[model samples]
Target chain A: MKLSEDEIRRITLTAINEMGDDATPELVKKAVSRAVSKLDTQPDFSKSTSSNQGRLILTSFGLNQTGVVAKITTELSECGCDLQDISQKLMDDFYTLIVIVDISGSSKNMSEIQEKMNKIAEALKIKIYLQHEEIFRQMHRI
Target chain B: MPFEFEEILETIKMTEIEHFDIRTVTMGISLRDCVDRNIEVTKQKMYDKILKYGSNHVKYAQEVEKRYGISIANKRISITPLSIPLDAFKWEDFVEVAKTLDKAAAEIGIDYLAGYSALVQKGFTNGELELLKSIPYTLSETKRICSSVNVASTKAGINIDAINLVAEAIKKTAEMTKDQDSIGCAKFVCFANAVEDNPFVAGAFHGISEPEVVLNVGISGPGVVLDAIKAAGSCDMNHLADVIKRTVFKITRAGELLGRKVAEQHGIPFGIVDVSLAPTPAEGDSIGDILMAMGLADIGGPGTTAALALLNDSVKKAGLMASTNVGGMSGAFIPVSEDQGMIRAVENGSLCIEKLEAMTCVCSVGLDMIAVPGDTTAATIAGVIADEAAIGIINDKTTAVRIIPAYGKKVGDSVDYGGLLGKAPIMSVRNINCSTFMGRGGRFPAPTRSLTN
Candidate 1:
């Protein structure tokens, strides 16, 4: 079952009210998606798995500007990389972008993708780092 | 599963803002099979084996760095003590072997190659004696080869004779490299109870009991721990310990992950993850800074030892919980010259040699990277070594002395070595002579604590 934008927003608001001041935006989204995906109806998207198939993380930091997301997403899609989740914030006058990507369908290996991303990062005047998803899980989950 | 956004941000900040990094990935290869009665054959075999095993080491490490986005600062190699395999060789032959090791290290693009060393804790064979005699020349002649001499252990007692020999050799090394601020001594260490799998240079060597090949990882992040403590503002002692422990746990886990990956790539066994907070000369990356953050006015002031004791214990506890194989001096390292806060303390007269000795009793290694006056006598250096050895013996811990006697430089004159070895300010030593004590030359018996049998 695919939930409408309004339904997702209502579920997030309900989660926020239940969780009080401690309910972060990420937490609210996670809770609502988890509950909705647990129902008998099939969700529109596949759930995350522990497989090593094209899983990666990309982080970028630089001056805030317009069209940053559009340019990055366009380049990512061209490389056959799918953006799983993305979070962006402007703090202390600089923009920070954290993205989780699935690259199993990509035409390039990790190093090749890194080389392409390096060119884009340089063109955009930002510093970009690409890492495997296992680093995050090994460091944070256990 | 999706990673927590805060956790990913924290990891990035630790590497970018803070100076957290993998200090070294040292491959220890046993050279026992290279032994030959013919010195030339021995040297040839040694060089061939190192080149064969170490050819792709730097490339593989770089590939891993790019894949994981973690920086590995140094790629180094350690071999079985040269004295063991080259027992029949003379001092000149040993120098040739040192040159071979140095050339191989340079060819492989590694920064340092250790194990130009001798283990004379109980007594010295003729080869060990010759190796000790060749150390000053070996260190002065080569650029990448490091030397270490283990003169004492808990079960073997202090080898005063070997300590005296090393003291004289250190003086000679300083005199030979006087043009470069006596920098040759920086690559030398005298240890009590040295471990085989230590990944840090100037002290690492493949032990006889180890396998043919192993990979040991040394992870360092004094800056990360300092940031964690600052984040937990005004917490009590127990809470402070918890903060440090949790932070170190994360650091060690990251190191373990990298170690396993690197070892698997190289087709070698993962030895251990050394969770030592080895500091560099950068700002905010000092062990002394961590102590100051923990409420010490100065690194050598009152309560300094207690603070260091707490920090060291907490690091070990967390590392044990995080890693399956935690070994090789796994605690906080307080190398004076390498830590900017430590250098500042010495310059301001708040820290002194004696206080550093006291602090070493509770820390990872003892009296590291210190520089004393150039005119300091060999007997006096031996006195310093003897004191550190006694501490290690009684406590059954690893202690080492890597002091530099900056030739023709007096107290307050600093010697700058520039990179990770950093700078050293010549500090005052005791004026009293200990020649008679050093001249006694007899071994100090094993301490009562070694009677665990």
Candidate 2:
């Protein structure tokens, strides 16, 4: 966290007040550093962590066809999405695919990625869903 | 993989096939500051305030839905109960204010906007009386404004005079909107022990204690629970409850997460997640079916109340454990028109109003979406509301009456409103005369439950 000039001035004044009669550059530096470190260590439990993260789970399913995985992975690679995990299964002649990707590196945001996937789904006559991974963790884990 | 394969598939199945979804995300906007000496100015302020706070409600909710891959069924708005802020307005001005609310709702593209309400659980103020007198005209005139009045509570007891006046209002609303099968009555709710943070509409209001604006959510997934209970097979009640709890716990967690995300998008405070098993009219999404899966032959069966009680308890327990902000009416909702199985039971002669009343004693709401003969007297309607209120005040729970007297309709005829309103088969109400008792109305004294402190 970067402190603005006003915040730094306020912190300096507070540190000087604490250092009182022993006012010295070294002691003031120590006090200010301690306060900044303390501010960095305490967690803000009120802020929702999921909204800031860019990891998501992608699920796609459709009839068995060639190049289905290739088409999807090709799009993700082009968008700079880092695929962390991939799982696939062929059940009753239908292909079910699940992939976990970190999209913070991608050029596209969640809505943009979903819009692209929707187009691919429509072209291939398949169904695709891209959801933030926080939902899965919240529902399935403690 | 960080998640088990089955876990991912389970959530997809719940949303894609099991009819699991967030029932509503309601933004509560306070209109208290919109009061003015000029009626037109009051209406304009109310309209402007609603738009300022709620214009982006639907858009923000849709973004969250896409982000989470779960659908939000309805995006609605609730405001400070109109009667409170506009207490000095006459009956005609009240109707004008309601029309302004209806316009605001339509402009924001919401299906319903709640909080046209008053709380006269003990006695009425002059403003409340005028508001009550305006309800019929308001309901008949407005297309999207939903109204509710709390005429009883555990601490304040039942206001028999208010109940009587509300009954007459219901009759007038029904007759005035009879062209649409008394659909106006569907937009009104009369409550005993009405909750402040309820997200469900026709009964939701931004209470006086609430902040300037907040976001509250109501979750629905009776289909998911029904499927879980069926998979449990022929087990003891203990194992059966375990199945229900496990299912509800996951759903409640998801519900809270969705609610928080929606509130975050709005840059507002996240309120409570009402863990209600609200059902839709679609097949397989019926609370009645869940009861049957819990070993009842049908809803309104001998063990129906027991089944509902167990289900309601499990919902509350799991919801409480899942979220610290669990509130509203956190239990099972068994509206007749909204649940296919309940509609089937009523149509098959297996369910009656009396049985439904007994069942409401164990559920979140009372006598929801039931239709009666067009000729049902106002005294009879008052009797029904009073009975529901008595149950609520005595038990210290929330119960409501949203009954419709479908005009020119009787015991075998049904009113069909497509979409979420669904359909209601007119059921026979007892013709027993209750005016003699209704005539002697003053106030039902607060019960012993009020002395808990």
Candidate 3:
């Protein structure tokens, strides 16, 4: 969590923007010092808490159509799954969607969620795959 | 935060478009404790041990697949070579043991069960000879049993007598299963320096040195490597090697992670990860395709062996870096019938048995899945095995021969064994007679290199 000189400058500029006309050199310096100290004391919360929740990735592939995301997310929400991230792209009339969800909060088990997802995929005429997040991490990271 | 969208997309693309997968998750179960003086009792003990240790193997592998969105193509089991425990029994008893293995494999829902094997690198024991004699009948009678015989090693030289016997047994197996394109030969392999922890089939068997039960994973991705090379566009040899090494590192890491998870789930030790570029008959998944991507006009051409050496070395280096324990035949596999690109090369006359032999000198395995004419002599088959064994012994690397004598078939005829075994066109062998050389049945002494002590 070390802040570079560039990052400190950016923080100082942001503090100035917040202070407006009241921004003086001494006041800005004080704000910058406080900010640096606060960052030093706080551990990287995102990194530390990343594995606290169960993570799942859902991918779908099929013909391009409307409301595919809406239909899928609605089903996910109904299962008490929280959508954490999503990316979708369409090329040559073919649609591909990759959705990451935090399933720790989900009321349903993995198999039950899979069964529901499979039915939705069948109804939509798309091939949907659900896998845990660790797979992607293991494959992509060293 | 460093995991980019592009990387995720690449993994997905490899799986969806390139047929990337964990080829096999094999559970190696040692059956040394199942020995008994009574043949039937020994057979019963083997069945019970395999059932007890491997009943949940397939289910656990499936769970890992579902969790990771990765496909595990096969769940298999390998036991200690059967000869050790059944040595006191008759040849008929070995067949009964093969039947028991096949029954347990079917009952436990595994595709193949390996370990119907004998080790006679130097010389054969009575029990080893009995097991070797039972190979044809056992393989023809059973559906899921695979067998291997280690006939040579660097430390013990070549067992010429054992090679001759195995060659004859292979011919007999083909004759017995000629109705099905001699499919039984596909289940047998003769090794020069066989390893105990190989997770790939037709040769995989739990060695006596291994623990009671362990999980070994074989990862295959010729498609992924090809994609990475294509993405690199054009580069120097060093840069190309770097690209392959980096790509293989990622692939092996993924396999190691999955293997550890599966082993943990099964409460067993995680054995080695075999990072071989094992190809299927699927289009775009061929090792030959990888060579073609490397600017080769055709496989088995002038530069094929050099390209293979580079690919194999890069794979091993990257795999070693990615995992603490990397063993088995961790190199590029060039099985003729199993790889579609190789099949095309053979059919087009660009590749031949001679060039394939030369390639095996540098690649992982030896003359594998090759189909010869029905009229091939057992002496000629022995010559082939001896040649491959000499290369392995001199180089001190594991080599195997899994050739099929296609019965009632000659050159210009192709036999289709379907699925992973694929189709192999009958390739002509050298016409020079080696009966005089093979007639002198004796041990080929260990090489000068064996005097390291």
True-structure RMSD, every candidate: 16.8, 7.3, 16.7
Stretches off by above 4 angstroms in model 2 are: A1-53, B450-453
In candidate 3, the residue pairs with backbone N, CA or C atoms under 3 Å apart (3 or more residues apart, or in different chains) clash, namely none
Candidate 3 residue B11 C-alpha distance from true site, Å: 1.1
Best by TM-score: 2
- What digit string (tens of lDDT, one per residue) describes model 2 on residues B361-406? 9998899999999999999999999999999999999999999999
Sort the candidates on lDDT, descending order.
Answer: 2, 1, 3
Give each model a TM-score.
0.90, 0.91, 0.89
**TM-score of the first chain of model 3:** 0.61
Model 3 residue runs over 4 Å out of place are: A1-53, A61-64, A88-96, B450-453
* DockQ of each model vs. true complex: 0.23, 0.30, 0.19
Query: What are the runs in model 1 whose C-alpha is more than 4 Å off?
Result: A1-53, A90-93, B450-453
Name the weakest run of 10 consecutive residues (lDDT summed) in model 1 chain B: B444-453
Q: What is the number of backbone collisions in each predicted candidate, taken in the order shown?
A: 2, 0, 0
Please tell me how candidate 3 rates in CAPRI terms: incorrect
Clashes of 3: 0
